[model samples]
Every structure is written in C-alpha cells, then in structure tokens.
Target: RKMKGMENLYTLHQEMGNILLSHVLIVRENSKLEKAMTQINDLEVRFKDVQCLDTSHWSNPAPSMIQQLHCQIQLAKIITQGALVRNEFRGAHYKPEFDLNQPKDFDPHEHVDFLEKQHYGEVQENEFPPGHLAYMKRFEECNKRWLNTTIAEYKNHRPEISFEAVNTSLVQPRPRKYD
Candidate 1:
C-alpha cells in the first residue's frame, strides 16, 4: 500500500510539473507575467492564514503540513520573482510593455545582452552578492526537497484505476460488493 501511494505521488508530481510549465508558457505568451505576479502576491497575503493554526483536526488539515506547504509556495514565488527581476525583459513572465507574440525591441534577448554587459568586468566572486545568493540557494534547496517528497508520496498513493474515465464510460459497470 505504501509503495502504491509513492507511485501515485510520482505521477501527480509529473502532472503538476507539466501544468506549471504550461502556465509559465501561457503567461509569457500572453504577456500576463505581471498579472501572475499580482496573483502570486495575493496568494502570499492569503498564506498568512496558514500560519494561524486552529488546533482542530477533524475540520482542518494538518496545520504544520499546511504551513510547510505554504512556505514552499512562498519560496517558489520568491524564486520566480528573482528570475523575473534578473531577466529584465519579460522572459517566462509577461509584461504589458513587451508582447512576446509580437517582436519587441526590448525582449529577453535584449535583457540578457544588457545583463552580460553589466557583469562583463565584474569578478567571479562579486557576480552575485553573498547574502542574496545564500538566500536564493537556501530557498532553491528547500523547494527541491519539498518537491521530491511530494513526488515520492504521490507515487506511493495514487489509485491504479482510471477513476475519471471509468466513471464517464458509456457502459456502467456493476458495483463491487465489499467484503
């Protein structure tokens, strides 16, 4: 049963990754990166609720787990924000000023060029500030660990039967008699 759960977790993790990538592409394609940023900010605000534990288990999910997940989401938002900031022009994120579908003078290419010029003569040690790099690395490491754990659990628990497809089939199957 535990192994089945882990397998389910793995499948879920893969599906989620694909969905996230699609979202990123859509945002970039539509030049709605700023909109996504705003939404993420709103989510961050809502995340405050996770911190407030109700101590009730029957109605509420595990507070500690919820809090940890919330933290992971926040970390992802932070990393995304950093990437957006680093890539001045809209890269994976959309900016109203630059439309990705159409050719714009200020594209990601231009932004990369600018960044390259800005760091051309900088020493390797000074490329990224120590404090900022440390924080980013820490967030990245934690997020990776969270994702790995989630995938492991999903793979272990997912149902083998295609529940949705089976439910929608033209021929209804007889209900099973449980022992």
Candidate 2:
C-alpha cells in the first residue's frame, strides 16, 4: 500500500525492456511485431494493478509516473500501428514485405480537407500549438506525397488516424533527390 514506494513502477518499466526503443529497431516480419504488441498491450492491462503505493498528490511522484507510463503505452501502439499499415520501404520506415525502392508513401494533397474542416491550430498554443495539428505526429520522408501532414485521433480508447493538408499553394513540391 503506502509503503510500496516506486519499486512496482520501476519494475513495470523494466518489464518493457528494449521494446521501448524505436530507433535502430529492426523487425522483419509482422509476427515479431504481433508478439511485442501483445506483451505491451498486456502490460497496459496489468498496469492497472501497479501499486502507486504513494497516493500523496502533494510532492507525490506516483501519479506522474503512472501518467508517463500511460503515455508510453499509447505511443507504443501508435508506432506499431503505423509500422503495420505503411506497406512501403521509404525512409526509416521499413517493411521487409516491400522493396527498398518502392513507391512514395504519401499523397501530397492527402489531408487538405481534414485540415480545412477542423480549422486546426486553435488548441492551447503550448500543448499542440495553434498552427500545429494533433493526436499523433509521424516522421516520414517529406516528398511531394507529404506536402501536408498526417494526424491520428485516439477516440474511444482507439486511434482513428487521418491526414491533414499543408498550405503548399505558394510553392510547389519538386522531386527530392540527394544525388
């Protein structure tokens, strides 16, 4: 109870282990992802039992730790889902199922409608910034297909992802080449 301290939370984090590291992570097949996600998801369910032990809101660290853990779970899900959906091998996003030189991942005008419809950028200037879109922000190759941006809305404990348009009316996107 109150004497539990943060050992339980620390143990939970340790349980996640290396699955939390997204960078330099290489997984060829979906089954690997399936297993990792299953563990993380199961961790989420088990997290409910995580003994905060210290419920003292004043100068208490348990609440913050729990909040961070919750956010981590959500982010893990986002990364997994994005990796699952994208069928191409563009930039750092790689799926062994697709060729190294596959087609571009995004459509330049993909999210224009969603952006305009939502009248975005009105959120707290701090949290999401008025001009920034929200829910989830992903970093993919910025090519013509990605002229705007993509968004993911986590609704009803699930993520409903969509794209938002970028105001590229002034300048045009050209072929991006490093050679």
Candidate 3:
C-alpha cells in the first residue's frame, strides 16, 4: 500500500511537469492561451478534494461548485494532448524566472492617500466634519508609531494611544485627547 501511494505520488508529479511544459509551449505559439489557462485553473479547483465547510456532507455544495467542476473537465482534455509545445517564461507562473533582487516601485504614502481620497468622496464638498479632521490628525500623529511597533511588542504591552481607542473617542460628540 505504501509503495502504491509512492508510485501514485511520483506519477502525479510527472503529469504536473508535463502539463506545465505543454502550457508553456501553447502560450509561446498561440497568444490566445487564456482559454487554456482558464481550463487548467478550473481542473485544479475540481481536483482539490478538500471537504471545506460548504462542501461537507452536513452542508450542500454551492451553485459555484458546479461551474468550477465544468471548467476543470474542459481544461483536463486540452492539457492531456501530447503535441510538441513551445516553452517561454511569461505570466504568473514565471515570477521566479525574472530578477529576484530588484526593489519594487513602492510608495508608502499610497494607502494613506487612498484612504484620504475615500474619506473625501464620502463627505460633501466644503462640509468638512470636525470629527473627521480630528480623526485624520490623530491617525497622522500615531501612524509612525503604529508602523514601527512589532506584533510582539503590541501584544506584550497594548499601546494606550491605539487607533481603535482613538476612533472610538472620535465617534462620540466630544472627542477626548489621549494622555
């Protein structure tokens, strides 16, 4: 039984490699590999036999599960073909194929800017809520400290001047300044 299990595992790995190589080839020759990729994705979703909360005997399968199974079957048929396929590094699977050490063009202020924009959108023009401004100011002041504090440090000594506490204060009619 153990030997059979090992053989099955080995076979699965070989099949996976073959499928990947075939996908790479199809992608190289025909630019329209989206359909093929979609099918492969579908097959993967169905092949996964995990009994999640929605799929358990106690609970019925969701409507989406049927659609997922349909996609898996369609993709499996195309991937099993033995045709000579081209190989090229492209798409999500080829992440490690590119330069690993290159730093991402990250803007730390992007999230803050987005939050501010979202807040602005929610409020009417020239109708700046005093509470909103207070909250924003408090956020800006604590933002640096919040970023610097590690999860371990936070768990050990819960920060008195925390975002949650500050937000709760702001929601009230008269906000109290944290000591």
Candidate 4:
C-alpha cells in the first residue's frame, strides 16, 4: 500500500508543527496566535496533496500517518482559537499584555508560609505587594467569569468552540502560584 504524496504530507506536517511551536508557545499574544492559525490553515490546504490512493491500513503505515496528520491539524486549530479567546493568563497560557508584574523581590520559596496563609485566611491585605491586591481582585473576577472547560469540536473544516462547567464539587479550586 503505497501513497503517492506521503513525503509531501510529511513536510507539510513538519512545517505546521514548527509554525505552532514558534507562534502558539507557552507565552502567546494576539498577532502571533493569528499568524499561527493562518499558517496552519495554509498547511491544511496543502494537505490536499495527500492523495490517499491506498486507503487500506494493511502493511503500509502511510495511511495512518495521514490520518494522524489530519487530527493534529484540527487539534492545532482548536488550541490556537482557544488561546485567542482567552484574555487572561491562567496556568501555562500566559498573555503578557493582560498580566500583572510580580514584585521585584518576590521569591516563591521564601514566601511559601505567607502564600500558604493567604489561602487559609491568615494573611493580612497589607502584607501583599502594593498593587497585588488589585491584580488578585481582577484575577478572581476573571476566574469567576472564564473558569470553564473549553470544548472544541471540529466540523465543516473548522473548529466550533464551546464550554462546559467544570466539576469542582469534591475538591475546591485553589489559587495557583508559579513564581
């Protein structure tokens, strides 16, 4: 089972992956995300070259790779679109423009006790950095509004985005700290 354009499809997939890495990385912004989406779309269009002459999965794995490529492209689109809609920084999806700066002297290890107390209602407001209270207020608001499971479905050659309420009944969501 030989495919005529397996090599071309492999190249396109490689290019798509590189584009995704360079643009939709850990730190993201509007323009780069859009660029990544555009490039991914371009690569998807190029996927037409993948002439699956042999559809059978007997012996040859080219068909399997092509199927995987299709899935990878769709997933990339979903991730890019999801990141674009999310305006606030949460977890690894950080957007520098919409985030606050940490205190210059802040060290997570040094403030472990304080950070623990903040979650337990033992820390005072005055103990926080000057502008941290405002940032935290904004973060809490964002959490209340945007904290949901992003469900993406691929249809009509594009991804349809939806959200579902996250189940937090058993264990409550706690504030996360990376710094």
lDDT for every model? 0.37, 0.56, 0.36, 0.75
Better of 2 and 3 by TM-score: 2
* TM-score for candidate 4: 0.75
Instruction: Compute the lDDT for candidate 2.
Output: 0.56
At residue 42, give the lDDT of candidate 4: 82
TM-score of predicted structure 1: 0.30
Compute each candidate's TM-score over C-alphas: 0.30, 0.56, 0.20, 0.75
Model 2 stretches with alpha carbons more than 4 Å out: 1-7, 22-28, 55-58, 101-149, 164-179
Best by lDDT: 4
Q: Pairing residues by index, what is the TM-score of model 2? A: 0.56
What's the ranking of the predictions by TM-score, best on top? 4, 2, 1, 3
Candidate 4 local lDDT, 79-157, one digit each (tens)? 9998888877676687888775554555444355454676797867687767665555565566676778888887888
| lDDT of each residue in 137-163, candidate 1, tens digit only | 333343333212111112231212111
- The number of clashing residue pairs in each candidate reads 17, 6, 2, 0
Residue range 1-179, candidate 3, lDDT tens digits: 01111122223334545655655443233333444455455445444442223434455553245445444344444433211121212222222222122113323343345356656785333334334444444444434333221111123222122222223333322222212
Clash pairs (backbone) in predicted model 4: none
* Clashing residue pairs for model 3: 25-86, 43-72
Please list the Cα RMSD from the true structure of every candidate, rounded to 1 decimal place: 22.1, 13.7, 19.9, 4.4
